[model samples]
Target: MQITGYKSQGVAAAVDLVNAVTTVEGDASFAALREILRVNGFFWHEFEERDAEPLRRWGRTLREFFDAAELETAVSLLNELMLELPMHPHLADHDPHGLHLHFAPPTARLPHRFRASTLMQLSELVVQHGLGRTGTCAAEGCDRVYADTSRAGRRRFCSEACANRTNVAAFRARRRTPRTPEGTG
Candidate 1:
């Protein structure tokens, strides 16, 4: 839950957003990052009292890009452009917060931060947890990604609803298949 500093926070936020998008059906249909961030608080912008419309639109756009089938390609190219190394910066204290290394500029355009943070976190996930942990929901018709944060990395479906639905469907399939009188294979 609690990541160490800004770098950690940024990476965590990226992972959280990626996981959130992957679990739903389609390559990229969901666009609820603002709500997700409001609940999770990825950046100080979300906490701003002035106006959050800009942030909301930014979040939506990020989701749209994330949903793009070419996301991997884009991230790879962006990573090259940003020149990110496989390193985590040390925590340094900052305004209104404790020690934290600013992984990104607070004033930077929303898209820049969004892409940078996402790519960085995804790269971290691949290195730290292995790409095996990043996966799609097992339920058919559901195309959301799953980061497997559960105790057992065996999480298949995006949610309990999908899990239940898949299980019920499996049970029905079994019932529909005529049994071979127990003696024959």
Candidate 2:
């Protein structure tokens, strides 16, 4: 729940995977998937062709949490996955992230490791913050999702581009609206 830096990687990797597989413009190709793992500090080298279907399917399934509109709905989905996944929680020490918890068993394959980590981290996030820290992007036409693991956790959009676009649109809308004179009814 107190995850920070790379220690909070599962949250980020979940977001990335969800976006990659769920967004219309996303690249869910094999290479793209591998890059996502590498960028998120997962074991990209171990990724196999056999892992693709499950990982892609997991992304589709995990997107439900981000799309959930109620705490009960999100909690139910996460709980179901938690019960299904085979988790073996243990401590690990490694570069770029020091000591932290690893949820998957040591012998688990890359995709299963990903699923366990993401599922546990997401469960922890929901437990700590309910639905406040993850959601679909607020931009008008974006389908991407996001998870906010930062201390402030004030995020609402998935990216700065969407944020800036929305802000600029709002500014233009406000400027276009004719304001009544001061004190006018």
Q: Model 2: runs farther than 4 Å from truth?
A: none
Put down candidate 1 lDDT per residue, 18-87, tens digits, no spaces: 5544433222223455544544445534443333444444334334333434546545644564574233
Write the residue-wise lDDT of candidate 2 on 1-185 in tens digits: 47667657888999999999999988889999999899989989999999988999999999999999999999999989989987889888977678888988779899999999988888888878889999999999999999888889999999999999999999999999999999995
Q: What is the TM-score of each candidate against the true structure?
A: 0.58, 0.95
- TM-score of candidate 1 on Cα atoms, chains taken together: 0.58
lDDT for model 2, please.
0.90
Best by lDDT: 2
With candidate 1 superimposed using the best TM-score fit, by how many Å does residue 167's alpha carbon deviate from the native? Answer: 1.4
CA deviation > 4 Å runs, candidate 1: 1-32, 44-101, 106-111
